[model samples]
Target: MRAPLPLDAVLGLASDLIRAPSQGGIDTPVAVLEVGARALGALGLAPRLLDDENGQPVALMAEIEGGKPGPTWVLNACIDTAPAGDRGAWSLDPFAGVVKDGWLWGRGSADSKIAVASFCHLAAELAKSKDSWHGKLIVLFDADEHTGRFGGIKRFIKERRDIGGVMVGYPENDIVNIGARGFWRAKIEVYGTAQHSGAVSPVPKNATVKLARLIQAIDAVTPPPPPEGAPFPLPPKLTVTGVEGGSGFAMVPNAASLNLDFRLTPAFQAPVAQKLIEGIVAKLDAEIPSERPTKIAALESWGAYKLPADSQLGTALVAGASLAAGRPVPGEVCGPSNIGNYLADLGIPATCGFGVTCKGVHGADERIEIASIPLVWDAYGHALEKLLIG
Candidate 1:
């Protein structure tokens, strides 16, 4: 009943959010939430800041009570994004939030500052015309989605136990992301005697060499190939992320750590995956003899989660997507994310991908089509309305 969210306002808010720069774990999300809170409050919704005991705000949640009681819907959009790496790679300032040529280009513009903007206005419109709707809507702006630590969404999950249906505003090209591949955060350390580079050159006993050996061992590990004709875009496996060692040319590295990520599929659960990582470390420790041997530690591990029950909320969302995208959109899609698994583990019907189509999400010159913004926004709102009416 309220006027459809103003187009100009949505664009302006997206630009402001992109400029704010809440880069996941690096920047505090408090500033982003504060801005969101002010906007929500001005629209006559109660924007409450939820924080940990240590006084760190997880995010701002604004609630709207509809005309009648129905299912509660959690509308989530992350305030944080992956750090904008190598600023020079972007043609425009990564934080510029430039809207032109029918596109919004910037670091977070596509990935989700757009959703933040759209969802904000959606909440306001719903609140203004609560009499025209049923059920409750919670607009949530969360943190640490990019870094995947004990972040905003996780903390919020813990704080709010009684949840209904959840819809995540992550980019999926107008398609719903039904399942997300799970992964493990691990570090492999290869230790050796530290000495001058010249002294260690003869025997190659430095940590870097040990690191190479460790990599070779891990590379030798072959997980079973994806089952014939898998639907997943990428198969699950170990991916070496970082090499931490070698201070300078003058010194021989004593300890080099390799940050490894293990992506899991339905075939491999946590227990099986955990043992596989341990076996790699054990094999290297026994094969190579050194007082300071190779060791692998799991910083974190979570198995892939497939929804046990068929989700009616998911059906409603897919239908909504059809309305928004002007075509039937499939709800089943695969992507890399840990949050959906986390939500599923808690027995919540959760899924990501309800935003503008994105390109170069974690790379340079990231962007999204400006037209897709309102499209997904309309779909999300319509879906919520349908679910409550049901």
Candidate 2:
């Protein structure tokens, strides 16, 4: 059919994206959206900037009406990039968008502006051959993927929910990923009676001390390992990422808090994980004097998501994509992705795949394979055609 997406053009688009600094949670992400919108507009589609009317998050949406009636297909890619950490660690200027040794080097090169570039490439090609498909293709330029709030998609779905399915783009090596592990977040407060530190002996009944001990107790409990020969593989994990409290340097703080981060497997959903944590607190409370008490409140939680074994999206990806890593070899081949996790919860048939995955995501010197750009573009087009034309 249409010529395979141009390798040079795809890389050129990625370079443009990498050149724009949309460091997640830091940079505003407007420039990247502008870049994507310009690219889509150049392809002769009517692209629109969508604001999150409920609040601050915003996204760019481009819709292409098919010649015939059918379900709407969505292609989504997050425009925000994780901040490039410690620039000195990178061999090149983190924002330079340097192309060297057959790779595109920059912070968002693979995590995941490349996927957005791939979406643009697919849209361009599809627009050139618009008659072959029968359904509308909606391309979403997600604006708040890495803001630590997941603001874009969350806002979008709230406004529109009749989507047939979403074709999500996130880095998952080269295979089409159909599932992802679970994640939970919480805040725990350890309370104590504030008193002058000078009057205290061994930090007597200190909230900070109580908080540290509770953290230690949590660390001591071993979660059950992934099942033997488990089809989908991921070990449970818990880490206390932050601790805060104390009103002043002169007194013992009355309340101290710890931020809980948990990465879970299907074996432990939110309630189960919450119960386990509660048990640990209860046991620790029994060992402590009644004067010191602790409480944990869940801030957010999401269970692991797996598409149906014969899911429509999964099957299409398996048959449609030609990956550098070879086709998806069964089992669960994925990591933590808000894209997969959210769609899976919506019971939406979504599959994530990309031609390349970068090194040191959320770190310095991120880069993606230069050649795989066109490869993934082709695969995305194939998947789109299969879903739209069939």
User: Would you estimate the TM-scores of all the predictions?
Assistant: 0.91, 0.91
Q: Tell me, by lDDT, which candidate is best.
A: 1
lDDT of each: 0.77, 0.76
Off by over 4 Å in 1: 1-5, 128-134, 200-204, 228-234
Error of 1 at 384 (Å): 0.4
Index of the highest-TM-score prediction: 2
Q: How well is each residue in 338-369 modelled by candidate 2, as lDDT tens digits?
A: 67687667766676654465676778788887
How much lDDT does candidate 1 score?
A: 0.77
Give residue 174's error in model 1 in angstroms: 5.1
Candidate 1, residues 1-390, lDDT tens digits: the string is 436658888888888888888887788887777777777777677888878667888777887778887667888888778899999888899888898688888888876778888888887876666665667788887766777664677778876767776888888564687677778778888887777777735655677887898888777777777677765544677778898898978787888899988788777666677788787777777776677767768787655755433677788888888887889988764647656777877777776776787788878988888776777878887787687654
